[model samples]
Target: MNIDLRVIGEAFHQFLINIGLTSGQASLIDWIFGALILLVIFIVLAILLIWFERKLAGRVQDRLGPNRVGPFGLIQPIADTLKLFTKEDITPAGADRITFNLAPTLAVFSIVMAFAVIPFADKVIGTDINVGVVYLMAFASVSSMSLLMAGWASNNKYALLGGFRVVAQLMSYEIPMAFAMLLPVLLAGTMRMNGLVEAQGQFFGLGWNIWIMPAAFIIYLTTALAEGERAPFDLLEAESEIVAGYNIEYSGLKFAWFYLAFFMNTWVLSAVATTLFLGGWQGPFVSQVPALGVVYFLGKTIIMFVIFAWIRATFPRLRIDQMMSFCWKVLVPMVLVLFLLTAIILKLGLPTIAVWLLILLSNVAVFVIALWLLGKGLEKSKWASKRLFTPEIPRL
Candidate 1:
């Protein structure tokens, strides 16, 4: 049988016509394909992050991490997934069974939903919503609600305390986080992730947003870590104090969901950090190539992930009081000052000298103020302890 190329091409065209797909509809098909690709990327990234975290933690603690599972432990996450799936699910006696079952899923769901608004690259965004940043913040708050549900449903006092601590900590940091985020939005003039990335690209020849607005960058990094509930700010799950915190009672697949959510949350935060401060997806000599922006985006996200891991490995967890005080007393003030300085710079159209001078002054002032506050807090703590320990005459 002779194969006619023109006949085959005509048959394919007829098939497209049969399915109500014009060339324009083909574009929609391409978009859907792009989205599926992004979903795959997300899954791969999540698994990679888990493996990276384990290896990093192992190295830090002087142990081999997951070396037995697959070559170089590359398949450890897959093994862990199979194990969690086959394990028996347990609901504690006297637990609110419905919410108990739903809580972990909700936590995972909220994080995945937040990813919808994030732009992975110029053309690879899932949904380019105008209120993308706000959407992210909203879903992040939902994580707190999930923790609350998990805690309350378990009927455990420790879980409740952990839930309360998480909610309180998230609330305290959210204000400063929002304010710090505003500086970037002010500079970028839009809340969309693509717009933010584009704004960064516009200034690519100058520098990354981190260097242009160092104070805001610092505030953003600190607030992001706090919001992410990473180490130092991760009192929500302080195992030594609260015995696994809000997820103490969860097990099997449910527990796995919570764990997956934590990984996903960190991944999204890294992506957001990459988008906002780094020249997201805008690399030197890369954007010139068509469709290579995703490479740059992934690179930035991975770098941010490494930074997150480094901080987690390096810093000791902050106490609850210290966490709250640091966010409100230190970060909020610094963010507020940064916002003001950014506003003035924008309005006055100042030269580089003026901008650098303002940044220097702001940093110096913040350092001095933080030092003074720490000194006062220490003195108060000592005096209060002294009075509490003082021998009292029998006033009774």
Candidate 2:
């Protein structure tokens, strides 16, 4: 019958019906089945990502990493998981035991909730909410609060400072991130994640939003990194700075939860990018064989993950002040301008290609202008260097 929207889910419902279940019961059962499947897939990916990151880091740094565990160190994640499980759970003597323990769990849980809206294939989303895009952003904001919990609960000055840093960072970046996402919403006229993908449909299976809104794509990627706590945005984990930041006092499995959440956030960020810009499950042959959609989605996600790892390997961390300044002084203004530009273009009722060209031009101009300003600022900073000139004596 109607397998066009969500074939896998529809097939599962049929299977349940064959077993003599009523429609309502089968629908409920199918949802549970999908949820469980999504959970298992998330865990498997988290394990693989941990291993991949370590191996990538080792190669980048010219050292062997996790060579002794499994084939090509493939079982390294399993070993690490066991290690964390076996370690002592140390709660600081001065810590608030309840919040200390609960924060990590909440950290992990908040991100896991995002797995529900991601569509692995058409109709295969975990109960596609009407406002899937908004849901993801809201949940992402909620996860940051968990960092505050961890930092304050530890009762250490460093932990408290790290919490403040996270709040400040999240606050600074969230605006640009949300505004950046609205570009796609502006074009698609819907906040549904699936709708965003479908709206990108064009001649020759190339309706991805990235081509239409390249500036938004770049901004989204940058803000996504900040949101996910990836380097060079990983101020939360600055060991020499804040003493390992919010999770400083965490150890053992509780710490493991925070650790997993960090990487899991990375995965979610990449997946969301894939969905919004790269056309989540939209690809050749996807219409004929729906399972292929999952392949395309995963492939794009892996590529995004590699870029994340490359940044981690290549760039040094930014100072907290620098990070905050970049977000506010730079990204915020750029995205705000982008928002008005998007509204004006849509209001003008231009041809799709014309709209695409105008936006692309604006994005290029913004990029060039941003670089020029940054470079000029760098030159000014060079002139202001205390080493380059005598330090002005303070008039006491």
Candidate 3:
């Protein structure tokens, strides 16, 4: 049960060379194989995610979900995919044909590219590039362009409005998200994904960044909810408001691409959050048995994903203005403050325990203050005023 993945990988690479391939060609094949493995793993996970969400939503609403498709509806996503394949592919008559055709591909592609830098386990990264964090940020921004293309190219008013919202929402949220991301890099002193994970591995994996920088972790998840366009913050595709938003005109497999990309992006965000704050692949015995690291990583990621699903199921969507205000007025300033505090604390040359204790107390203090301020702001809002002070009409 304990497989040495590094040895297997090396053996495969040598086998490719033995089959009359040049060293360069063999290396390219090795990379392609790695990419394919990642793709296959994600595609399978995407199917299960769709099913899990459906079941979760159904149970939340007191109903059985997709029981007719297969045993526990395991085959439902496959059936759905086939149905989408059979549906007619239509391009709106006035659409810019090229951009419309390319947008969905770009959306999915950008998310997939983000996986290139993530470490699933020890020695399990795709490419341990020095600028992996920057690489992830760059590709994530591409989704904005893809959204704009889909909306504008379709020549539809609703799509155009959704596109406008994407620019405003994603760009604004990225400010806080970027600042939140920088906290881990600042603490770890490296931008590599593996480095970030390794930095949290001290003291038998009990030294997670989440313990010392809880505020940043919360800020990152909040901004991630906005960045992924998940529920509550999902103004970009407010179905009641924008009629399915930017991808309204897409049909069949094209629409499926957008849908798949949304869920995949959710997984990616959860995985990144896990790696950064959860001491990814750092469980007891992981160093002794490397394969267990993969299991630990996946378990943590799934827990994070469940948090996302629970929030989606329970919280109502925010109005567009409220979402933007929360990011700029709340998360951005809080992250900036924490970032400054961290820098000053690091420069103080404190002992390890003292540094962690001070940072932990700072995070807790900031979190409580932010919540108190947010509650005060809510109490002052018109809705709260009306609800608290307005006379209730007698029910007939």
Candidate 4:
């Protein structure tokens, strides 16, 4: 039995060699295959996200979401796709035809480009580019420009307002978001997503980055939701006020493209969170099995999506002023402080327990400061509103 097992192992080794693959070469081939698989997975996930959002929104409002299409509305996305394809394409009479036509395409393109930089798992990355993190941030920003173009070219007031809101909200959130992202980069000591995953893999026991850096994780989650324009930060598409927002003038497949881009954007944001704070695809004993890393990565992404959904269900949208204040005054400063604390801990060569304690203390300090500031702001706002609105009367 031992001799037969040895022979089988030898044959497998020879087979690998015959394919022009050293162990490293075989691994590269596997990575390429995994990327292609992920591409398909992303496409399917986009469709499912549409169904999920609809079902979730329905539940929030106490209604059934698309039950007649298929089993539990499983085929609703298919029906929607077909309807979009067959609908009449309408371009407004005075709209800038070229820019209007190009906007949706740009939106979809930018999102897919951003996905190329995300490392799904340790060995399942698309490319190990030196500037992967920067590349992701850049491409993500391009989607905002697409929104700008779509709104501007449509020549609609509501679209213009929606685009402007997107610019302001996204720009404000990016500062804190970048700082939050920096936490993972500092911990991993690399910009490459694959490198980040590898660093997390070196943890001894229960050593995921999430536990090591809960503040960063919390900040990352909040920023990601804002970046994706999900609830509590979805003021850009305030339905009652904006009348369908930037895509108001869009119809047919053009409208579909906008919705598709939104779904893709959300998925990519969740994937980024999974790759950064959740250790990408690192799981105990899973690396021993070939290709299981990719499995873990997808599972992690799904969990992130569920969290996103949960937040959408629970939170109401913030007012515009409140949203701006929250991002600029609250999240950005907190993330900067966290970054400083993390740097100091790393510099001092502190033990893991010490590092965690420092992080906890920092969080406590931030919480106290924030509460104090909020109370002050509320009192001042009440006084200012009364003064401003209660002007001096001629008779009284």
Candidate 5:
């Protein structure tokens, strides 16, 4: 018998066929059902990720995280949800009532829409389009506007400042992120996400984009941290400077939405990195046991998230000048050079293995040189003295 690897969309269509539905009708139903499933899955995953981050942070700090709540404090997120629900939704006195309210909704909507093109497992995807990569990048850009709305509508100086910071910060990093993503598309010759993963299946466990394009992977991950506004790059809510930043005036469920969207974007970006660079759901025996594709995919996602949280725990927030400098001066040049190298290598018309090996070696060289340049720059930087004083501050 032929192997059965069809995902929910195909399986549902087959079921509808047996039940006498027309092909168009079955396809439409499949789409509707798949969309609902994805929405519900991310919503629940977002809840659990909140608790996961807390527990991980607790461990990193030598403490038990939320042991008093449901098993391993899994129910803590639900309880927190209940608490937020019971609190009054307070709008600031001078805030634009309409934009203030709509901002949170738009923030979450932008991220949730990106999931529509993500391929969770073999044959399991929300939608496949020729330009799936472009679609994801476009949708991800929309959330920046929501942050601006939240900041401007609040009428708070700090909030407005934070909004301006977001516009500068997010826009600066997007260029490098897009350039880093370009290598994978050039290699696969397809913007389709599933095709990206399938291209790496030939070598099983070893055939991964990260293996060949390590420089792009590094650039992508570093830029992703900035893009998602997670630690070091989390200037949007740099507590000491702005006291909660753009969402300072928001409270109750509205505030909850802002925070939740923050984490969900982190979650989504991690998943995207795994799909685009790592082997995604491909693994040894994955083809024979198709369900294992979901397992491998999720496992990679969790590993990626752990690295994200670890960075949050370890790094200090950067100053505005330093943040902008790193993007425009450091990351942008790095991705540009990597992109040019990829093009030149492809133009040489080398054999497949030779091309991958050359790219891998070139990536390793770039990473080492970038580190050397950073160290030299830091020694000459005026902020060196300030960083030396950072150790005097107490930690919780």
Candidate 6:
């Protein structure tokens, strides 16, 4: 049962080389095949995520969701996909046709490109580049440009406003998210995703970065929620306020791509979060059984996504000002402080255990201070002292 897919892949690769194909040609083919497989995986996961989120939302609100479509509502997403496929594709008459069309494509493309650097399992990555983290950050930012394009080219004021919000929201959140990503990169002393995972292989697969730098993990998750446009941070598509936001002009298959990309981005960010904080693909017996690494990786990613869905279901959306204020007034400063503390601690040339202890203590202290400050700010707000009910009043 110890089926290492890498061995099979390598054998197939060798067979290609033996059959009159040049090494370069074999590699090209391998890459293309891998890309196709990854794309297919994205599609499948998008469907599953849609179904899962709907079901989770239903459960949170005490309702049965999509049960009639298929067993446990599994086929609902597929049905929805078909519906989108058959819907009429529309383009606004006065819109910038080229940019409008390209926006959704770029949105999906940027996310897929970012996935190129994610290490899914042991020896199972799209490409093992030296600056994998940098590569990921670069591609992820491209989605912002896509949103801008979609919003500006639509010739719709609402879409334009939605696009502008993307710049304000994603750009602000990304600063803290980038700094938060640095904790693991610095700890491992390498920007490579695989290196980060291997660095956490100590302590019987229990030496997760989250244990040492929980504050960074929290910061990253918060910013990531905003970056991925999830609930509470989903001001980008505030349908109530902006009439569906940047993709408001999109419809039919064009709209479906944006929809697919949204779910896929959620999964990708969850995977990256797991890889950074959880001992990604580094569970018990994973070194002996490499295939199990994929299992571990996916399981951790799914758990992270569940946390995301749960938060989306529970928390109400934040006002735009509150969201931006939290990022700038709160998360940015906190993450910057956390980054500096960890950096200074690691530079002290202490023993490994001492470094971990110091970093953990610093993270805890920062967390408590941030909570106290947030509480104080909340208490000062007008809503704090206002109450609809009084202890002395009887029910009407």
lDDT of each: 0.79, 0.86, 0.89, 0.80, 0.88, 0.89
Candidate 3 residues 45-71, lDDT tens each? 999999998898888878998898889
Which ranking of candidates, highest TM-score first? 3, 6, 5, 2, 1, 4
Q: What's the CA RMSD for each of the models? A: 7.4, 4.6, 2.0, 6.3, 2.4, 2.3
| Candidate 5 regions with alpha-carbon error over 4 angstroms | 1-8, 14-23, 385-396
TM-score to native of every candidate shown = 0.85, 0.92, 0.95, 0.84, 0.94, 0.95
Stretch of 10 with least lDDT, candidate 2? 378-387
Model 5: per-residue Cα lDDT over 229-330, one tens digit each: 999899888888888889999899999999988899998888889888998889878877777888888889899999999999889888999989888888
Task: Say which prediction, candidate 5 or candidate 6, comes out ahead on TM-score.
Answer: 6
Candidate 2 regions exceeding 4 Å error are 1-5, 14-23, 381-396
lDDT by residue for model 6 (1-396), tens: 676768877987899999999999998888898898778777787888889989998998899878998799899999998999899999999999999999999999998887777888987888778898878789878988998999999999999999999778999998999999998998999988899899999998558998988888999899889988999899888888999999998999999888877878888889999889998889998977888999999999999999999999898888887888888988988988898999999999999999999999999999899999999997886545554466787769
Model 6 CA deviation exceeding 4 Å by range: 1-3, 381-396
Candidate with maximal TM-score: 3
Task: Tell how far residue 166 is off in model 3, in angstroms.
Answer: 1.9
Residue pairs with colliding backbones in model 4 are none
lDDT of 1 by residue, 1-396 (tens): 333323543565567667888877765665566566666766887888899898988898788887998898999999998999999988999899999988997998898788777776675577788988898889988887998999999999999898888889888888987886787788789999889888877545454677666666677778778778898788988999998888888899999998888878888888888888887778766555524677788888888888888898889988777777778777887778777766776787677556656655765666567768878886777434644765668976
Q: Rank the candidates by lDDT, best first.
A: 3, 6, 5, 2, 4, 1
Give the winner by TM-score: 4 or 5.
Answer: 5
Instruction: Say what the RMSD of model 5 is.
Output: 2.4
Return the lDDT, model 6, position 24. 97
TM-score of 3: 0.95
